[model samples]
Target: MKMTKRNGVFAVVLAGMIWTFASCSKDDDTIPANIEGNAIEVAQASTIAKPGTTVSVALSFADPGNGTMLVIHRDEAPLRSVPLQDGQTSYTFEDILPADLEEGDVVPYAFFIADEKNTITSDASAFEVSVALYDEITIGSSPVYQIELPEDGIIETGKVKLAAGRKYWLPHSVHFMSGTELQMEAGVELYMNTETGETYDVVIDEGARVDVTGTATAPVVVTSDKLLRDQDAEPGDWGQFNIKGEGNGSSSGHVEYLRVEYAGDRGFRLQGVGSGTTINYVQAYRALGEGIMPTDGDVRMKYLVATNCEGGGFRFGDAYAGYVQFAISQTTSFYDEVEAFTIRETASPVISNVTVVGPGEDVDDTHGMRLRANSSGKVYNSIVADFPRRGLRLNDKVTVTDLQGSTVFAYSYIFNVPRDPYRDDTENGNPFRGYLDAENVFQNPFFNNVTGFEDNDEDEPILATIDGIGTTSYIPQTVKNSAFNPASIHAFFSEANYVGAVSEAAADWTKGWVRDYEGNIHQ
Candidate 1:
């Protein structure tokens, strides 16, 4: 059963259909399963979208048969019910969003399911319909709403939601004090304050939460208003979005599909974070400093991309131990020394399936990776290429000792390094130069079209260009791999055996969602 409240985003243009399931025969003559107590879970959801945006969802569940039912609730009111046949599991909901919805107004929906025994479970999230977001409005401008913050700039009391359909400009840095929540809906974009040319930081204090989640199609963008006017805007217009935790600061964060642009010099910094956080599908472009910096603690995630960012791609340090996979980091500067991955101070993160496009041959100072401070992380089935200096460097004796002992750094390829491909610190005399031999880490691969990625600069996305020089990414036999299936190591990671982030078969993941340097978005 599909409920039409406020002519919602599920308007007539949505393929002329609503929630359709082969098992859900909601013809009024079928039975109704009265569900309560958070019954059928909303396993997945679509975020609030702009008007005229297409929204699609897929619903699937376990074998909750014995006559199941799904009930849709909007604004805490029971709307409609659908009866389901036993053993039926798949359903699809696709629709065009209503065009008249306003920003800041939430359309909270709940889905409850009832089993044969009538036991029920449910889940939900707020969905707001919004419109145009402008930087500045003159007299007689369109009726767009603006978020009003307290003069003190500390939201210490209740929840503050920066919904879609409105322009948001924080006059100053805002802090979500303890026990407060700063929620952002889908299609919500916030302008980082750049009035005084100082960094604009959003602090998620201890015991505070910040859920800045956007949908796959309508992502949440955190950029300055300058980009709206000038596509080729300079980066570093703002500062850090800091999530602080002092050795266990219980501050939680759920950031997905978020694009942080022109905000670096510490773009997104994290410390003392744990497994309770959720970070995926995140990007940092043209950052002034480290794109994503987690100096300490177990900060982990997947599907991260850092493009042309300054400082480095990801800087992990201070006893950090985490897991990362399916990541891409790139830079092409000749004067600025930028490392794709910088690890120091006992930070050891298990990383795999990454494609790092290093600085070109003109640069001679930066390595593709720098591991020091006794870091003991592992690298598996990845590609690190085009580095001018050493491909992989061990900055100290403690790091080399750990690599020879408990740390794992094997099953990856290092190519196009002009100088010493593998070398230790000069003070260490580079004596252990042959430690990372070609058997475990090699030099070349049958790259399909890796002409420094300049081959497909016009018609293709650079992230999707790391395809195998041949049919694959020159990966060895599936069993000759020291790379273990990532799923076995952690439940959060997907089962992966591929060598690099983008392969011949899986090269389209970066097609049409993220934004480019010119401020153009793919549909």
Candidate 2:
């Protein structure tokens, strides 16, 4: 089974040639009535240019009368039009191009004109050209037995053990084959790195079974080495740690008790056709896009957590027939916690066991979760809170079951407590229509310590400054009276079955798994 996403770029360079007619276009005079010439079409503009290089464009034009001026625009921004100087009756547009292209692609623009007095514009044209010169990062084509820290390596086409303090860079279609143990010891980081190819497919494909396992006591950490620049990292600076499989391989690719942080897009973009690949106890934090984006496959996840993401807590797009259990997602600026999960012309997903929390006000592009058109799925045991738009939205043809014991609706206690009124105020277009089973309750499913879960907020332009919870100051004393303490938040649960994501566990629950940033088991 082979799926190929082609990145084809079409660049149009329009050239216009205008000329003065001897007489009005008619049958009376011997001169031709109209001027026939090529119009300049500029397709793409503003390509990143390498420091020392130029992009040239081949231009063709037809002219009956006199030569015309050609004006070109580069990049998407505004451009100053220039004349295409013509010496002879016929015109050709190929010439010396602009030097000093920025480090990337140099998209060119060329405008053409026949007569200066007469105004004529050509169709817009766009093209993408590469000029950036990055040192080729080639990991020896051979496979290695074990890997170590600050080390550069590659896996071409077989099973490789990624022991402690090791990192691997994957080229397209490289498989991690089933039975591979990509283990990271406690405090160790497994950095998956990739460079942008000439194609728009910025997502590097592993095309193989993946096993990223770590333990809580020394939780396996997977991140981009670029994050070494700062203790705290930003999103989208690197590429995705993609694990690709047709989901037809051995059911051995399992990720447990691991923390994947600072991925360029989604923390884990898992697409394995096989049914056995499982991802559980995963946490994605400070992600630029979706925390977990599953496409055309299924992933079994438990105790998954994500924070400070722009897309959603978790997004299952395409035909991702999977089961998600004990999941929690919280933030302010994501598009939606869980979305329709489809971008193709027609594609839907099956998602279950979700908990989403976000600021309610829909200022910029804030949304909770949406089931888009022509998509179908079942949602059970989920709590959506304080979304700017609809809490739970049902758009197209979808069947949702509000299981008696598994669902909750309009629960005032869980909905009313958020300081961000946008989260609790339901008057806004309520998005949870499909899941509103009559058995679902709309009361405050009270927690043990409601006030303690309040997290810290810094005055930065982005997310909060606090790490885990508690403390306005470094000292041991409780910082603020209203601050939400992470330690106290989990303990606050009083009810039997939890409403949203977090839940109170048995005294031995901590032993089940080690907790990471999103509160997922690291071990």
Candidate 3:
């Protein structure tokens, strides 16, 4: 469990790099042939830097004969030209990024060496690091910040309780060993120290647990410490919050009213969790990986929402059996075909009263609910809408066969999916292809807010200004099943008379928490 994900520590090629030449290169500014005196190669992987932060790089030079010049170009323009002494082969490059760079903006650079006579040595490596906004929660403002934590940031034994009203920071990845319980009180904000080191994750080892007790008014927040002035928060600002084991510890893995923002990996990952765990009113906003995922677990959750996630919103894998009710996953402006719900690896979860919103029509072929890898699940009283691709997709024949063999996929709604509402991606002609459309509605669920979706530039963006099943009919053909009774199923489910995540009769659960379309956190 060595969860080390630091930036600029490894010498690897970045994702988007421009290599000028494989063997040797000739450019207009270089001597084309002969004088093979100098060569250099980039020695740093991609990095994530905040505004006004130093972007560090390493370059290894080869055989600089006597006196040579190393020229660094930024975006194809010469930024700095350095004179290397004889036999200077290694250099650490550091530059202060401009504070005005926006999110998702990349700064590309390359280098060339001249041996007395101008000669191109090496092509440009890939882009170095990316600039993003950081959270502005400084430490040591009050008593809560003065609480004595382990100097090495490891909690091995005993129960630790972190109260509210002050800032919390993790220097690096913090590890909670077995028999340890970390209790986070309400109104607590945990931020990772980007200035010191990244990979500021919370790892609950085997037999360890975290009890997060937050309320709607004072929810616990896990975000970046780089959200300073003129900086915007992006996903993967910090590492993950991983909860392991069967969750049998005392009140372990019991989280409520917690909001995780801009987490690098999963916001909250439950691995091998069981029925003893409890989760309610949890949100994962703009996660770099899956927002909320449970693997090989029987975890149950309610009032869960993941919005604008770069990764899939709610994913379950490794034969997970969970109960998800009153959940929603919405994305806007991303075209990566990131699914809202990805059920894979033979997972079988009972999902009810959910609304899955997909990215816009500019995206490629994708799906809202991707049922694949022989995963079987029951989706009831849900709404899958506005997907550019299929609403419910089956990736293979085995997946389609498993879906048909599983329990109910009825009493849901599928709307505005231009690509076939239900599609067999493998096209194996499985007989159970239409299992997702049984007794499901095909009309608009937001009938009360038609004008809200008429414009994409409005305040609400792609999602409706107000989301609810106003006039949409939820004609359930049968009553509550015996399996969902108080004695049989997980007792987290209430009788749902509506089809979508929100009801016209009750208050929206996302009002006090969750981020809006403008990237503003709710108060």
Candidate 4:
């Protein structure tokens, strides 16, 4: 006969059985005489089950011929009867649960068996079903996916693919182990839970790799969970994206066409990243700390943009021997003597074709570039404009004579800066003023939107006028002859006869991939 009755009847029977068994004496272990030597055993069940999947329960028993019956009881549900075939010793029951169960719900189940004259009821077992945390993405190998995370927070083995058009919620910091890879499809979004009051980071440890290769049209996004619920999330809502690379030889992996926004700290942290790794076409916006930070590595990057960062846009520490080109920083907020580019402590990065625009004259002492701690590099064909204070400052550790011999700043433009264009307080006297007078131009780059620098009101919205890619309102009025030294220019750079970051020509390098922060469009 088929199993029948509602969940209430099952609950009542289960309660009565529990009370009766609890009150029974320890000496009452005898079996009925008719089923004397027969025994029944149920295998251990799973502790957890995901929604929309079947739970399997296995049982083994000795039959006493007189027609046996098995009934499965779940709390508040009808009893399910299983037909025991002739001469069968073991059976497996696939119990499919309802899809609407909440994630943390505990379900109780019990098994009952009976012969012609005797009946036996097994102890109750409980399991928890997981709630759906991500939208449009599935986890695990089973048809009903399982949400499992180890206690150590590291995914030690296997490759997991985060499919496109899905948003995954990260509740804690996750680390990837050696030889394992986390591949993210284009248009995939990773959101961090910010309400927990603890910062969450995605760290790719040494020997591990994160292959997040997205197209210009469908870039991968890493942002705060608050932004997923409401678009008005502010900076410092979440932690950063960190990639700890294998030291200077081969790279651990690469990340391309990625956008990170509203990060609490640095947007991207490259630790010990070598020359073999590539980080291209990346944009960081509204970061509480530096937009991109490099420590102890030889980095290679191009087409990078940092906007509305409270700290410096690009901050380099230690020895970073790399090439950075086509970079742009716009409207960095004043943060205790911060600048667009903060280069310090023996970093010699070859930076070219860049633009740094500051928040206007009212913001006190905001710099375009703060070069200190013996940091020297070849900065060419760049524009630094509208800063409130000195355009470039060389700190006490470095001198003009040291710069003239070790660094090269050629064909660059510094415009609209007030109160000392070049400051040198290192006791070596001011050689930077004479060098600036001789090598660089102090004129406007004639950006497409000159009005972007007109106001200094702290409450006003800072708009990004120059798209940097195509159809920008800003272009240098004159392309200087000294911009390109054919003898010293690297082969990777285009020999475009332009002085600043942007040109009047229709073919702009930043076109099609660079994202417009204000408009939220990839031009």
Best by lDDT: 3
Query: How would you order the candidates by TM-score, starting with the best?
Result: 1, 4, 3, 2
Output the better candidate (1/3) by lDDT.
3
Candidate 3, residues 157-219, lDDT tens digits: the string is: 876556554356656777788889888877877766566545678888778888888888888
User: Tens digits of per-residue lDDT for model 4 on 1-523?
Assistant: 1122223354466655544433442444443333443445667743456556787767777663546666566643435757666687777767776675543344566655544333443433332223332333332221222224567778999765565555676767788888888777678777776877888788888888888887777788887777555456778888888888776655867788888888867988888888788788787877888988877677677878787778878887787767787777776346657877877788877777777777766677778887788777667767677777766667747644432356655556665665555545566633433321233322222221112222432112122222332112234443433436422556645564554555644545455555454636645
C-alpha lDDT of all candidate models, in order: 0.60, 0.42, 0.64, 0.63
Ranking by lDDT: 3, 4, 1, 2
lDDT of 4 at 394: 71
RMSD of each: 14.2, 23.6, 22.8, 16.1
Q: Where in model 3 is the C-alpha error above 4 Å?
A: 1-152, 228-230, 247-251, 397-404, 426-490
- Cα displacement (Å) at residue 13, model 1: 18
Please provide TM-scores, in order, for all candidate models, with all chains considered together.
Answer: 0.65, 0.47, 0.61, 0.63
lDDT of 2: 0.42
Q: Could you tell me the lDDT of residue 145 within candidate 4?
A: 20
Q: What value of lDDT does candidate 4 attain over all alpha carbons?
A: 0.63
Candidate 2 per-residue lDDT over residues 326-421, each given as its tens digit: 566666454444431222212343233345666444434455555554445444434554544444444444433332322222221123212232
